[model samples]
Target: MASTSTSATSKDSPEPSPDVRVWLGNRQAVEEVTDHERLAAMTDTELAQQGEPKVRRAIPMKKACTFLNIPGGTPLLEGVGTVVKAWPHMSDASAPAWVASTSGAYASLLAEHFGGVEVREPEDPDVMHGPYTTDTAAVAGETKGKG
Candidate 1:
């Protein structure tokens, strides 16, 4: 049967793994990306075994966003009040925003809504419902940057 697990990221810097090493744009790390063009090239078994590069960072993704784009006062749902309390600075519509979901059309749409912004989150296989097994990942795993 399929199972799930979680683990804590070490406070130290990211450690190296066989997979490519870099940071993703979104600040949830994504889960079940399973469609990146690059990963498509890998054989089923290869892709399954090729888990994300192991990483370590003291701060969690949510904490990274605690101060980001936060409004000075309570946020308004709609109307001109929204104009005054928006994120990334209410005065700058061009300031920028980042979406954080599994890589796919939903994420794409969210980015497009923000003028094709992009993902700003990261995923921890240990925590975010994964550490996907070779069998479970036989055909997916294509997100880029940090996983």
Candidate 2:
């Protein structure tokens, strides 16, 4: 299954561009997907192009860095073994916790999904200290704290 994300704005495309749908693991997007039927017809190569993933706020991770698996859902990752700090989510944890932060794939996924994982800049220690949620604005014209 392809993971569709609309947060990615085309770098070269101009204003009011349509949202790009990306495949999270591949760290890429194929332009134009309005439904599952169309998306399902795309070839494997089309599904795996080098399109950019969206970055909100936080340090961009590198290929060599590591990440904690907080959400732990679909597309299971092969971790480095043993639970590390589940920071910004929990203190204590269980197995299969950390995974390679390859090409910022996992970091991008967490950022997009608000999956409770982050790679903050080491020099900037003040950005994240506790649980955080991205974008206070909710869907359907509803603000986070309001009805």
Candidate 3:
């Protein structure tokens, strides 16, 4: 009778090492990775020599909005000025606000509209007061807010 053994290592062959797959455009290759340090030390050329084309993943707007902590479809206030200075509890403890508008009339209008007082100077000099909304009627082929 004859005896036989099943083994990965044979007298004529050696064992294979672990490898990592990387991507370079349309080509694919395999690379033997000794360890994480060696893999991290590999150059772009070396990585590309043994990599496959990578697939990109896209995130939906709803998922992205959830991740960003902002509600979807919220219009950004473009022309709103940043708070250069804040006067909190100057007159009343309950009312706290910032001096953001430069124009006195505009500031008065804003105060009347939003129930806030207008200050002589903005806490921030860089902030400006203006009408910032786009004319949707004009965009839709109607003459609105376009004089």
The numbered model that scores best in TM-score is 1
Candidate 1 residue 47 C-alpha distance from true site, Å: 59
Q: Candidate 3: TM-score?
A: 0.19
TM-score of each: 0.22, 0.18, 0.19
Candidate 2 pairs with clashing backbones: none
Worst 10 residues of 1 by lDDT: 134-143
User: Cα RMSD (Å) per model?
Assistant: 19.3, 18.7, 31.8
Which lDDT values do the candidates have, in the order given? 0.29, 0.27, 0.24
- The better-scoring model by TM-score among 1 and 2 is 1
Q: In model 2, how large is the Cα lDDT of residue 67?
A: 25
Which parts of model 2 have CA positions greater than 4 angstroms off?
Answer: 1-103, 115-119, 127-147
Give lDDT tens digits, candidate 1, residues 2-80.
1111122245636421111111132322223334555656687886898533322232343222111112122112211
lDDT (tens digit, per residue) of candidate 3 on 10-57: 456554311111000101111222355555777889778965333222
Cα error, residue 61 of model 3, in Å, equals 26
Q: Taking the candidates one at a time, how many backbone clashes does each contain? A: 11, 0, 7
lDDT of 1 at 94: 49
* Candidate 3 stretches greater than 4 Å from native: 1-96, 118-120, 123-147
